[model samples]
Target chain A: MSDNQSSGPLVWLGTVLATCITLYLFQGILWLVVPILLSIILYYVTEPLVYRLTHHGWSRESAAGLVMGGLVLLLLAITAVTLPRFASKVTTWNEQKIISNYVQHGADFVESTLRTVEKYVPFIDEYMMSKARDNANWDEQLAKWAADNSSHTIMGLLHWIPSLLLIPYLTYFILVDGSQFKRFLVRAIPNAYFEKSLLLLHRIDDQVRRYFQGLMALTVIDAACLGIGLKLMGISGAFVLGLVIAVLSWIPYVGSIVGCLLVVLVAATDYASQTWMTYGAVALFLGVRLLDDFVFMPMTIGRSLQIHPVVTVLMIFVGGAVSGISGLLLVMPVLGVMMVLGQILGQLATNDRLTARYQFRKALLRARAQKGLEA
Target chain B: MLFSLGKKKNPRLAQLKGVSLFNDLKLSQLRIVNSLLHERNYLESELIFDQGDEGQALYIVASGKVRTHRDNQPEDKFVEFGPGDFFGELALLEDAPRSTSARAVEDTVLLALFRTEFLALLELHSSIGSMISYALARDLSRKLRKAIVSNENPTNL
Candidate 1:
């Protein structure tokens, strides 16, 4: 028991070292991570349906197939309905004259607003004027950056398209053979910790599933709220804008701010003459943010991740630094998994039965040693 | 995409039926239990588990024979268990150290039902769970009664 107790910390340290090495190796093949992560998300999203089908006597394979088939059909229907409208939107957006007019008018409005501020506060005119010049230069730089990155972005998407096609195939295998895979993993555990390890795995699995489900629910609600608000305010392509914002909103607090700024910019450009409409867009965003914080978030995501606010903020920054957007999206879920593992390890350290077993073995070994000495 | 050649019936289901712990279960309930079983093969004299090791699963002999003995006991002081017999049933309820070590007496096959999997099944199907729990309690009661009787009259056996 004493020997086993002493080795516990050593085992934990070894595990942490192994994990760090694994992650470093994994970063080398990071391109493969996105599809695998997406497949995992897809698996959780479709798992309940598969389980329900199995409960009703369908084979696991058949149920997985049925779900995947339904998903493909849904994708086809969405594409058939939306492709032509999307193409037209793209063509309209490509008309440089309309875009240049919007940008010129937007810059003029900002300059005028700064002049009005300078009139009221004369002493800060120099500082305000410099800021206004910086803002104008910022806009030009942003446009130049977008123009430069457009081809690179398109090429990235093209590369991703083939890998994205692998998600369903990966998800299908996961759904059908997941249990066997789990059993295979369980078999690797030492007999002493086998049941405890299995329980820990199940808990982690449940937490991850809930986290993904909550995220999906949150995305849909956010998009719907944004879409309805923008449409009622007479904005064109409200649904599309809402969808883009919703996807971006996966980056947590930063995403929401970015999304709000995007909507306001679009409102300023497209409906500049009606200044009240810009205010309306701002009001609409605040209302949605309030709804998200008070209602949608608590009900959908709750405190399942159980991360501290400070740690979550730090994680977001670190993730952004490490792997950019994908890392930002994944950080919270990864931390949640880590927390679960940490909690399990804590439990194992204090497990009475396991400790008692160790004591028993220790006593047996001691008895044998004493008997040998007597001989 | 690995396919079995045919609808191979799990032989362990038949062996499970003979165990008193599962005697009250309906065929459909038995089938559900069967789905949770994992089969393992052992060569002659191979250790199934060691005395004082933590137990996580109950095992039923699907074929051949097994020997159970305490580490402190003489080698000949062992119990031979054959097909349809089960051991370590207490593990299904709680994690506990094995009281006796078990080994295959001959090339053998055994079916193991892990506690976690069993608990999951119970959570999903409460009615079956209650029935199995009741049967398990009754079986334990019977075994306790037999042990008490044997202890009271050592010469009877």
Candidate 2:
């Protein structure tokens, strides 16, 4: 009975130890984790289709192959259609007239704003005036930063191509074999806890699947809203930028801020003279944020995770500190899984039947030990 | 001998048809149900599940025999179940503790349909879900009626 009482804490301690070990190991192979995570996400995305096809008498292998093949062709078509157009846009964007004009106008707007501030508060005008004069080449600075980041981004993508190529292959296997793997795991569990363990696993699977599918829906809707909003405001490359921001929004707090800054900068650069358009762009972004917070998220995701806001913020920071971007993206889902496991385990600990079984098992073990000693 | 290899024909589909829970399902629905089943082999005297363990799956005896007994009751007060007989139906409806322990009376082959898989199937095909749920309810009602009748006239046994 005493042993049964102590088992829960011991299990929790072991879990903590295992997690620490995993974190330590994960840091060294951070690069490999991306494709694996993407494959898992892709598996979830494509799994339903595989099951649906199998229901129509197609074997699992054939269904998985067909789905993955279609995915590959779709990706190829998108790349072939978009790459040349994107390259031409990049060329036009780099032109001196387009970039320099936008930058000069941005600087002038800032200068005017500072002058207005100086008018209201005379004490800081001299200091602000000095800073504004020194910041006259802000356009050139902006261009330099853009050039540096773009080059870095291109190089990073090129390096990532090999890993990215593995996604479909990994996804194919996962779709085909995921059920078998789950059954194999279930079979490995001891008979005593088989049902409880299976229930816990299923609960986790259902919740995670819902959370991810909801998240995907949210991202797509956000991208469409942002893209249409920007295009109506006459912004170029609006769809592409919207898509980028939508993807970034997966990173919780940091993502929204970064996305906002990106929209503001691009709007300021493209429609510099029309300050009202810039304000409109900001308004559009805020409106979308409001829609996300109030409508889309609630409808799609609901309160599935049930995480406290404070805990979420803390986990985001901890994840960021540990694994950078990937950690930020993954922390919420990991926390959700942990929450499910904790809830199930807590229930098991309090379950009268389970507690009694634990005590019985303990007694049986002790009796066996006593017999061994006598022998 | 309970886990002996059977003929080339897939026994699972045939066995599923005999189970009352799947009685109303169409051919296509039966196939879907068949896809979700997981088969296990148990030796004679092997414990299938102990009384008081949480139940999460409905098990159908594909071959051999099984006996269910309650630990608190006299040893003779137990039921023997044979091929095509299903138990743990309540597990399919909810996560509940088993009321009696189940063990293989001989080498047994059982087909288990887990609650999670069944729920997933229900989400995919409402018609099949309705059929199975209805069958389950009817089966439970019949059992309750039989038990009540027996309790009213104990000499019937």
Residues A1-375 of candidate 2 have per-residue lDDT tens digits of: 121233356554543344334444566765677788888888877888887987786877899999999999999999899989877766666564444445555665566656667889888858758676676577578756665566456667778888889999999988876776677666765444566767778767877777778888888999999999999999978998888988888777788898886787778778766766777888998899899989999988776767567767877787767667666776665555555555566656676665665565556557656875753
The top-ranked prediction according to lDDT is: 2
Candidate 1, B1-157: lDDT as tens digits = 3422123675556677887667878777787777677667666666677777667778888898999888877889777889877877788887767778888898788878888777877766666777878877786777777868767322111
| TM-score for chain B of each model, two decimals | 0.83, 0.87
- The window of 10 residues in a row where model 2 chain B has the poorest summed lDDT is B1-10
Over A191-216, each residue of candidate 1 has an lDDT whose tens digit, in order, gives 44555566567667877888888888
Per-candidate Cα RMSD to the true structure, in Å, reads 6.7, 5.9
> Largest TM-score belongs to which candidate?
2
TM-score of candidate 2 on Cα atoms, chains taken together: 0.77
The superposed Cα distance between candidate 1 and the true structure at residue B35, in angstroms, equals 4.2
Docking class of predicted structure 1 = incorrect
Off by over 4 Å in 1: A1-28, A88-126, A132-136, A339-375, B1-18, B21-35, B38-116, B122-134, B137-157
Query: What i-RMS does each candidate reach, in Å?
Result: 6.3, 5.9
Candidate 1, DockQ to 2 decimals? 0.15
**Candidate 2 deviant stretches above 4 angstroms:** A1-24, A51-59, A87-146, A345-375, B1-35, B39-55, B61-66, B70-75, B82-84, B93-110, B119-149, B152-157
